[model samples]
Target chain A: MSFKDSYDIIVVGGGPAGCMAAYAAAKENVSVLLLEKDRDIGSPVRCAEAVGKDGLEKILEDNINPRWIAATIKKFQFVAPDGTVIFPQVPMTGYVLHRKLFDFDLGLLAANSGAKIVTKAYVNYLIFENDRISGVHVRINGVQHIIKSNIIIGADGVESRVGRWAGIDTTVHMKDMETCAQMTLANLPLDDDTCVFYFSQKRFPGGYGWVFPKGNKTANVGLGISGDRARSDSASARLESFVHDHFPDASILNKTVGGVPCANRLPKISSEGILLVGDAALQANPISGGGIATGMTAGKIAGNIAASAIKSDNISADFLKRYEKEWDTACGNAQKRYYRLKEGIRKLSDEQLNKTAHVLKDIPQKKQTLVKIFQTALIKQPGLLVDIMKTLNPFS
Target chain B: MILLHDNKCDFCGTCVGVCPENCIDLGEAELNIDHQICTMCYKCVWICPVEALFAEKVK
Candidate 1:
């Protein structure tokens, strides 16, 4: 396909957030162009490929295809630093996804909605008109082009350049960034319907390890350490030791490394003519570092807002504040609560974790709900009691 | 000075995100660092998962 001189809206990055934004905007009959830096929509999977079943269903509705799911998770276990396991009986369902396929499918949806998709199109910088964000300077196939747009959506992942270009403070502190490494391993025997998390300050300082099953004796084994704590050893080295100690006979299939922003959302996510979604806006859960569902949510909101802003021809930062207000009401508020809880959880020592596990072990498995577990874990930090209640409040 | 080992670098952009200077550009297949702009804070070097980045003294 050839290039266009201008578009009604330009969506950067082809991840879930980007595609969803394109899909929503295009569905509104606006001219949308989606740009992806990678050669493919989802070739290099950066995430652990897990999402809540309800969240996925809410976005895709009846279009939830089985092809994108690798494993259906029904339960999860938490391993304390002392090796004590506590399985909370929370009523939730999740899926280990084929992110490559899932992301590609979302892209297809956007294309079907009349959005133009372009891969390997690197956006070098943003174009400003009269000191207001106007468009972008993109380079594709060694040739550069300036594409003007009424609005720009920055759906780029953790390494978001668009936000920085627009003068938003997208910098993550060393203590808030999670330096991660993961390997897909085969022949590793694990429960197909269960996910496992290991917490150990000694092993994974300021972070944790996880084993997410992909099915049939295969899993994604990985861990993330806070940037401040990763100075002593690389994340790859830590994962290597973890894999060796846990699944000695498993064969490594693939290796991936990246960073996850575990901090709260940016103070500003929208400028005059640009809106930031996904990791660009730091929408990932602070405690769990999950962004797929939240990214999609942000994308849908941004896309819809972009369409309205274009139709009304009022693309000022003041008009775009609607996106920020709506986002905070929808998911950003919950993320703020999660960030508070994460801060509380980070202060727990290994001994405290072990003690919490021991205390939870005595309760009947059926009565060990997630709320109960958290209440016991944060018993010492009375201040966090209100945060726990607010974080887990279903009504709010 | 900051040095990046091509053999070890995966272009995953982990270092790009934490660079306070925002001087690193992650291309499709290669990672580039603008040394003139880099302050040698070593934040990227420390956060690199693969140990692909290094800090060296100028000879």
Candidate 2:
């Protein structure tokens, strides 16, 4: 069969957002193409692989695929420096995932919906015609292939080049970027149904550390320190030392280091015949740096919008703005609030965290919530009053 | 050029891991250094486990 040089929609990237976008676009029976630069769809994984059960339930179906899940969590613990642990008694569903399987399955779902999948395709630029995106110029198998498309979706992630090529401001401010380093550890016994968070200014200023258990004996231990404060310091080294000190007997099996965009949201997400989803649009959860569910949500919305626009023959920026509106209404407001909370949390010091932990320890575990955690953090730095008020306001 | 001595290497693999251009390659036994696509972020130098690999800042 001759390779078609055009598609109804070309979705760049095959991550959570890209996969969902392609799946939605193809489900409409439109000829779609999903491109992934990685040899394997989800190899060389990132993210801490923790997602709330309620959040997953809304997005995925019952009889959830076990291949994607490493374990199910039941408890949450946040420890401050000096090893003061505050057990927040909120019941939530958490999952440690096998990201490679999860991402690959999502891509396959898109393909099953009729989206053509291609790997090792590097998209270099967007093709423009008369102030509209016509398609993308990609190099696959060392040969440049130009695939024309009516609508383009950017699911390219933090290291995205598509948003820039499409003329969308994709720069991540150093202060807003979380420098992260993670390791899969063995021989560390942990609560199989509990995830632990450690906050220490010296170790992770402007960010925090996490231990998401894969089983009773294995876990993904990692930390994300705010890039701004770490300008002269090494966040990754600090993380490694902390891990060494905390888990002296554990062996590091694999390591992944990357940056997460902590920005609230891109002011604009769509342009003429083009749209951005997931990390490409900075849709990551502000405090946690988790975006699989959020990105997939945006992808589904973008696909629907693209299909509607194609049917109406109106794929202009103004027409595509509906995606921005719908996505914001669905999840943007919460992300914006979380961004503010993240700033507050980033500014906290080890002393402050310890103090907050001390206070939370006194409070009944059953009474603890994220709001109380923020309130306690703000107790020392009352200058963040406005933020506290905004946080207290449930309307946000 | 990038060279990470096994004895001195911390095995952090930060050299290969942080390379934006995917220049450095990590192997089980030794670090694979690629000079072709090195953007020279020097992030690896800061992250090396045993201070084995260092980058000469380009002038």
Pick by DockQ: which candidate is best? Answer: 1
> What local lDDT score does residue A298 receive in model 1, on the 0 to 100 scale?
92
Q: Write the per-residue lDDT of candidate 2 for residues A1-396, one digit (tens) a residue.
A: 135899989999888899989998888878899888766788768678887666666766563688788888888888888899898765467788888899889888998999999987877788988877899988787789899997999998776667767877766665677777788999997888888988888778777889999875889999887655664556557767888889999998888766677778888789988899998888888878888778988999999889888878898789999999999987898788778777777777777788888888998888877668777887766765566555542211
For model 1, give the TM-score of chain B.
0.92
Predicted candidate 2 versus true structure: per-residue lDDT over B1-59, tens digit per residue: 55566676533333442345545543323456677766666655554434566665454
lDDT of 1 by residue, A1-396 (tens): 697889999999999999999999999999999999999997889889988888888877757999999999998899999899999886778999999999999999999999999999999999998888878999988789999996999998888999899898788888889999999999987899999999998889888999999998888899999999898999999999999999999999899999999988999999888999998888888888988988898999999999999999999899998989988988898888888888888888999999999999998888787778888988887887787777653211
Chain B TM-score per candidate, please: 0.92, 0.68
Model 1 clash pairs? none
Task: For all candidates, state DockQ relative to the true structure.
Answer: 0.83, 0.11
What TM-score does each of the candidates earn? Answer: 0.98, 0.86
Task: Report the TM-score of candidate 1, chain A only.
Answer: 0.98
What residue pairs are clashing in model 2?
A53-A93
TM-score, candidate 2, first chain: 0.95
Q: Which stretches of candidate 2 lie over 4 Å from their true place?
A: A61-63, A380-396, B1-59
Please list the C-alpha lDDT of all candidates, in the order they appear: 0.90, 0.77
For all candidates, the clash counts are 0, 1
Evaluated at residue A249, the lDDT of candidate 2 is: 92
Chain B TM-score (model 2 vs. true structure): 0.68
